[model samples]
Target: MISKSTIDTVFETARVEEVIGDFVQLKRSGSNLKGLSPFTDERTPSFMVSPVKQIWKDFSSGKGGNVVAFLMEHEHFTYPEAIRYLAKKYGIEIEETQQSDEQKEQANERESMYLVSEYASKFFQHSLLETDEGKAIGLSYFKERGFTSETIKKFDLGYSPDKWDAFTNKARDDGYKLEYLEKTGLTIVKEDKKFDRFKGRVMFPIHSMSGRVLGFGGRILNNTKKAAKYLNSPESDIYHKSKVLYGIYHAKQAISKEDNCYLVEGYTDVIQFFQSGIENTVSSSGTALTPEQIRLINRLTKNITVLFDGDAAGTRASLRGIDLILEQGMNVKVCPFPEGEDPDSFARANSEEEIREFLEENSQDFIKYKASLLMDEAKNDPVKKAGLIRDMVNSIAKIPDNIQQEVYLQECSRIMDISDEVLYATLAQIQNKEVPSSSRQGKQKMEVVREKPVTTPKVDQLYILERNIIKILMLYGNEVEDFEDLLLKQNDDTGELILEPDVQQSKVFEKVFLDLQEDEIAFSNEDFRELYQVLINRLNTGEEFEIGNVVNELEPSQSKEITDILMQEEQYELHSWDRHDIPVKKKEQAVNQYVTQTILNLRRHLIDRKLQELLEGIRTAETEDERTDIKNEVVGFNKLRTLLSERLGRVM
Candidate 1:
């Protein structure tokens, strides 16, 4: 466990903009930096980083937090991992509390597997550089493939000696247990034998977005008909091939900066293009592209230009990935090389300028590419043409944005010499056919009742009030203020009740806490209640309120709620009356009014709930005594509600 002081030091030293800039390309937007969301597929910039507040917000995905939270979300890192990352970035020495040996042994299994994989990656790299056979075989092979020494090291290329049990013995000698070695799939253990999985091959380390080695892919040099040409690590707890895109870790920053990604088919394809000055490229590692892989690219950019060989298999793979990209609401283009060339071969044969020029001049929009490829086969065949049109319309339907879909459909109509109306009708038919029967029935029933007005439940209304109160407490809780307290007293001489006000100075949090306690009010939501307790503890300690520190200390869900409240844009400057030469009241000027009203509204809501409960009791009363008791309770609650309403200047 990291010490609290060390965590605080990291939070204070780590700047949000500086930390996020490592992964995203942010341009100045007013006082903050704005960029395309790293969490969603966006064309326009919606991710904002505030250096002053030391926080960030992705409006596209509704994720916002301090530097640590951004790491946790973007890298899928644990809290400790995020902290350690920031600590390393800022050069802050971490001070951790010592754990017992037993406790250290019981650390997470996923982390254990990660440690073993990392060790294996280092072992492979050392063998490639230091061993004689490794240099003669694996290093020589990579050099022949046009990989320079710098590029090889940059991608962490390595070698596994041909001898079985070589890596296994070294790992065991280094005190790494065989159990974890097997779990990470670095070593294969059968009956009483253990051996290296990637023996006699050149190794490519597959990394997570945060650059952690998740697994390895190895290529064999020996040409045997029965032996697999390339071997990947088996599925383990740490690595899922379907969910990961090869080269994403290296290509993410370049992808974001260029606002484009170049997708290729193999590991060498990515390396070659990167070496040729196209840094914004990733590979599917020769697997069929999946939505999960597309989504990974989508996070960095919405524009994907797929590079393929002009062979039939490459064309088929490109066609397969197009609709998946469309479904994720991304724009995809295709760039194919000359008939005999692949990305690797083309990149190797051309200079950086030539490769870039080829990509710029040859890429075609997916719709046009698909049409050109399929139209030749459908020429003069009415049935085949009809099928092609339907296929195009179905692809258009996969697009979620209505405007984008319409634009694509219009282009398709023009290319196929069909009417826009026909395309629209076909699209609607396809969409209708795709809807489930239950969903169709639900839609029909909804249409039948469309005229009914919707009303929010009283409990939900109270919950909103509770949330608002907490928001105020978080934002202005420690600020001292003068509050007008209302009181009623009996005049002894005239025997009349008189209302009086007494002003007192107190912190906003103190006043709100005392008022709620006097009314015996509590949050109904369990999460809200937990947050309230944490806030109270902070207030009791008289600690300076730091949003980042508070957010980091809470659970992820609670932290999200706090971030949402803090990041919400309350000032609508675009619609401000100041533009028309009229002054409007600022929230800062009415802080007291806002706080008092929030409290009164909460009290009024709770009183109304009590009144409703009493009414229900009266309706179900079995005896006169019970009915009378419920009636008295209802009268008391109604009076309290009236008082609160009067204070709020609202009619019951």
Candidate 2:
């Protein structure tokens, strides 16, 4: 049997156009090459080959396939013969029969490239530690950056010697295929020439969450305007810069343990924080923060604290990334270093404890951080300040959680000392613009709706809230925990508003039942309404609620509804990542956040509907007293909505 690695190498090196060009006189036809059908007597060009897709089609003969398939069809060769032909033509080493276990492990092209990357990681580390040029340039740079020897080895820090073919020639000599080296972006191959992509650069191996090296981020140590300061592996089969996080392999456990992850901009920031004993840190590798990357962190923790450089201009430029975090349902905080300092510089100056303390004390939620940053510059100019306020409103509109959006708007109002009406009006305008919500980089849910000729999804907000309430009751109905309750009270002394956040321990069902009861609300969906009562009755018995027992008594449709409600969160979890892809330790499900948010969302949904009804009544009322009564009820509902908004943030 031909080894899978050999097959993969052959495929990688054998270009479809080049291989077919040997037999067919192909000519450029737009993006593809077109020639007369070789298998049939056709005067017009009917054989078309695409270099980009690496496949060919003979329209006249009705034959189509890859390079190897083409060889098998045209040259009357067997599968093995075609493989051998390409292997010999491309100079790829071919292995056949009696394959070793390691050779058997290479299943596909992507897997083979991964092995090449792993070897390259080791090669670079060896160069850093053993080579004279590597030690002089790379080792000296790290020492100058204050990276301890232990930290250096821990991160597998490495150096690529300053020569075009230093690493490339070595990789080839050691039986690592040039085809894979090129695919992994470690070597730039042109015609018959190839050279190391990161020559003369310090290599930081970017690892998958399972600790397998995916690619490299190479840093140029010298002051050279000719090259990028940092060069990343080009997007490949195994590596997507937007989807991977630097230091995530080392920081996953720490992030779940600490219940937070510190996000920075560069590789050294993560390395410095890790060395400073703050291992719960990661970087986007100098790229813009991405939702995929945020989602990668989301599996470990909901909280992300982004460490910003002291330069306010840079902060303002990337502050737009904060919206990505917000849209993905992640809580973001920002901590800016003192003027002219960054994570690397500050960590060098401060002790481990001071570094940790500084992060703790200085970190502010994104709302406060963004408002303060914009308010500073815009404060000096009235027109710019108006633009700043609108920009802030744009961010506030991106938040998916209604309660979170309301809370953020209130925060914005407090910071600008502007009335809540203005911000809320701007938010309403933005939300009602009829523009489809979408992201350019992501497989957007909106794009899916727009592109497919499917009926628009009818989202029932109230029904979703009801389903969520049932889900919460099903999971934590009998469990007791401290839940923060917001109570709006009038201060007797000064008649000022005082919101007291009372932490009360109660079973989850009790909290859900009482809140709905207090609001005089019932599930608008009959199924959820009926199921809610049944679950509450079971929970009220003071015995642990067994879903099995309750589900057994229900009708088939009701039972399925109940079952779906219980399993819904798992079924639609944002990050249902494969264990083989990245074995991230699972964080405990956030029972409290889910429970409280569901209840608040239910309240807001019901109240907003009620407010609309009251407004309608006020318009249609036949008498003065009737209109006055409706107006008073509207005031009461508005006040209640305000309290719910305050409780969303656990503050006024």
Candidate 3:
């Protein structure tokens, strides 16, 4: 387990802008840095990083958090993984507490698989550079393919010995259990014997977006007609090929910077393009493109230009992938190399400038490309032409944005010599058929109004007041304030009760805690109640208030809620009343008044709820005497509500 002090050190040392800026291109926007959201497809910037607050907020996706939270969300990392990542980034030496055997036994299975895969990657790389056989075969092959030593090292290219149990034996010698080796697909065990899975193949390590080795793709060097040329690791706990794209770790920054991604087909294609200066590229790793793969690219950029070889199979793959990209609401383009040249060969033959120029000149919009490719086959046959038109319309309907769909429909109309009206009608018909019966029923239900059941307004009001109080406590709980307390005392001469007000200085948290305790009030919401107790405990123990400290102690969902509260200021800051020349009261200036009103409102809400219960009891009373007693109780509660209302300056 990571020590609390180490987590705190990591959080303090890691700067929000510096961390996120490694993956995102952030331009200065006033006091914050703004960029397009890495989580969504958008041209305009809605993601803001505040260095002063050490937090970030993506307006497009409504995800906002501190540096560690960002890593957890973006990389799908566990809490420990995020902490370790930040610790490494900020050069903080982590101090961990020793765990018992039982605790160590409880280590996550996925993390274990990650460890084994990382070890295997290292083992393969070492073999490639250190072993004579590896150097003679794998190193020679990579060098012949025009891969530089630097490129090979950057991509973590490696080799496995041709022996059956070379890697398996080495891993066992290193004290790595054969169980995990088999789990990561590094070793294939069959009937009392184990062997390396990628024997004699040059290895391409596949990495997660955070650069952890998830799996490997190995290319066989020896010409064997019975064996496949390229082999990938089987699906494991840590690696799902459908959910991963090769070279995404290396290409993500470039993709976000260029606001476009170049999709290729193989590991060599990605490496060659990256080495040739087009770094914003990824491959499906030879698998047929899936929606999951397209969505992965969609997260970084809305535009995808698929680079295909001149072969007929490559063209067919591009056709299949284009519709999937459009389905995800991303713009798809096709860039085909000259006949007999793939991304690998083309990149190796051309200089960076020539490659860039050829890509620019050959790239065409997918809609246009599709139209051109299918038009020839449909010539002079009205039925075939009609089928082609329907195919185009189906692809058009996959687009979520109506404006983009309309533009494409018009383009299709101009090319196919059909009217836009016909295309619109066909799209409507297609969309209508796609709507499910349950969804239509839901729409109908929304259109019809139903009588609302009786609800406790006081309870709802109290919840809001409780949330506001907690928000204030989190923001300004440690500040000292002069708090007014109302006291009841006996008059000296008349011997009658009189209300006296006393002002006392105390921390805001202390004042709020005392006020709520005096009224015996507790938060109605369970989360708020729990947080309130934690804050009170911290205050009582003289712990200083820090948002990051509180967030670290919270569960992820609660942390997100706290982040939402903290980031509300940034969201509101974007809409400055000063820009409109309107007088707006600052929150700090009215802190005392706001706190007092929030407490009074909560008290008044509780009183109203008690009065309502008394009224209900009165209606259900079996005798007149019982009803009278309930009415008397209601009268006292009403008087308390009136007093609270008076304090809040409300006529009730």
Better of 2 and 3 by TM-score: 3
TM for every model, in the order presented, reads 0.85, 0.54, 0.87
CA shift at 366, candidate 3, in angstroms? Answer: 1.6
Q: Candidate 2: TM-score?
A: 0.54
Minimum summed lDDT over a 10-residue window in model 3 is located at: 576-585
Please list all clashing residue pairs in model 1, or write none if there are none. Answer: none
In model 1, the runs with Cα more than 4 Å from the true position are: 1-5, 15-76, 95-99, 378-387, 418-429, 436-446, 449-459, 491-496, 517-530, 555-561, 564-589, 610-641, 650-652
lDDT of residue 155 for candidate 1: 95
Clashing pairs in 2: none
Q: Count the backbone clashes (under 3 Å) in each candidate.
A: 0, 0, 0
Candidate 1, residue 96: CA error in Å?
Answer: 4.7
Q: Residues 268-368, candidate 3, lDDT per residue (tens digit)?
A: 99999999999999999998899878777766677899998998888987788787788777888899888899999999999999999999999998888
Best by TM-score: 3
lDDT of 2 by residue, 1-652 (tens): 7887888778767788887765555778777778766676444666777675566777676676677667767655556667887888778888877867785655467667877998999999999999888889999999999999999888899999889999899989988788889999999999988988998999999987656688999999888899998899999988999988999888977886787989888999999989989999999998888877887776556788988899976686568788998887778899989999999899989999999889889999999988887889887798999999998999988878899999999999999989999999999988877364444334466667778777855556667667777877776788887888877789999986668878898878888888888878877788888888888888898875655445545654566576455433333445432211111112463666667766776677778888999999999999999999999999988988887767765521
* Per-residue lDDT of 258 in model 3: 92
Error of 3 at 486 (Å): 5.8
